[model samples]
Target: MDNLGMVFGLTGAAIAALFAGIGSAVGVGIAGQAAAGATSEKPDLFGKVLVLQLLPGTQGIYGLLIAFITLSRIGIMGGQAPTTVQGLLYLAACLPMGFVGLGSGIHQGKASVAAINLVSKKEDQFGKAMIFPAMVETYAILALLISILSIFGIK
Candidate 1:
């Protein structure tokens, strides 16, 4: 019973990292496929496509940051353990990042694919091509901000 809070906190941390990591993996994989196809014909475009493929990976890093913060906050890494209520709050805080990361990562990957196609057709359009996928990244950044703020705000 006493450890319930720890369980919840750990679960929250896991959710934050796991879901976002899954999202990044899928997103990166999707983009990688597109990149491969695009570069197959014009190997010179490899550098450009590689950048796009890596963009979706930011969400996973954000998730990892949140999880690390959560763990430290809940005393999993050090101090006193959180109360159940605090643990629940931590779980709530992590939700935004988990859900948003998953959604944005996938969508960003799709967007990246489109951008890759655009770049493949028009190499000079690479800057504009980057914008489409970068826009999708905005949501992930917002979620990361909210999760970090929420976690820090929890007493």
Candidate 2:
């Protein structure tokens, strides 16, 4: 690929990573606020709320991992650049994590908040409450897998 193609590929990957980070930030922020509110009322639920808050962070880690892998494939990590179409494709593979992770994280946060409320009131059903939002995280994992496979498969 040409220099411009590599640039575009890198840009896409950076943007994807940024979006994923932002998604995680937003998701964690929302969940944290709600969790704090809940904790104030029920100090005993701190551990559960903390777990829920952390769940959203997984997407950001996935994005960062994909970006690093993509960069590695292009030799970007070692201060070199992609010089082939396949290398460009590897960089482009970083896009899915951002799009999927962003929305999924937010939705997951909302669900988790609802779940937290349910669990807080009915301690016996904590598992049931946690499951709904955790399930939403499955999409983020799928996106990460696709991005990783695409980057590796391309080159």
Best by lDDT: 1
Query: Model 1 misses residue 31 by how many Å?
Result: 0.4
Model 1 backbone overlap count: 0
Clashing pairs in 1: none
Quote each prediction's TM-score: 0.98, 0.90
lDDT of 1 at 110: 89
lDDT of each: 0.91, 0.79
lDDT of 1: 0.91
- Looking at model 1, residue 120 earns an lDDT score of 97
Worst 10 residues of 2 by lDDT: 78-87
Per-residue error for 52 in candidate 1, Å, reads 0.5
Per-residue C-alpha lDDT of model 2 across residues 1-155, encoded as one tens digit per residue = 25654675677578668888888888888888878988999999899888887888888888888777766656566445666565567656877897888888788888877877786788678778888889988899999989888877873
RMSD values for the candidates in order, in angstroms, are: 0.7, 2.0
Per-residue lDDT of 51 in model 2: 89
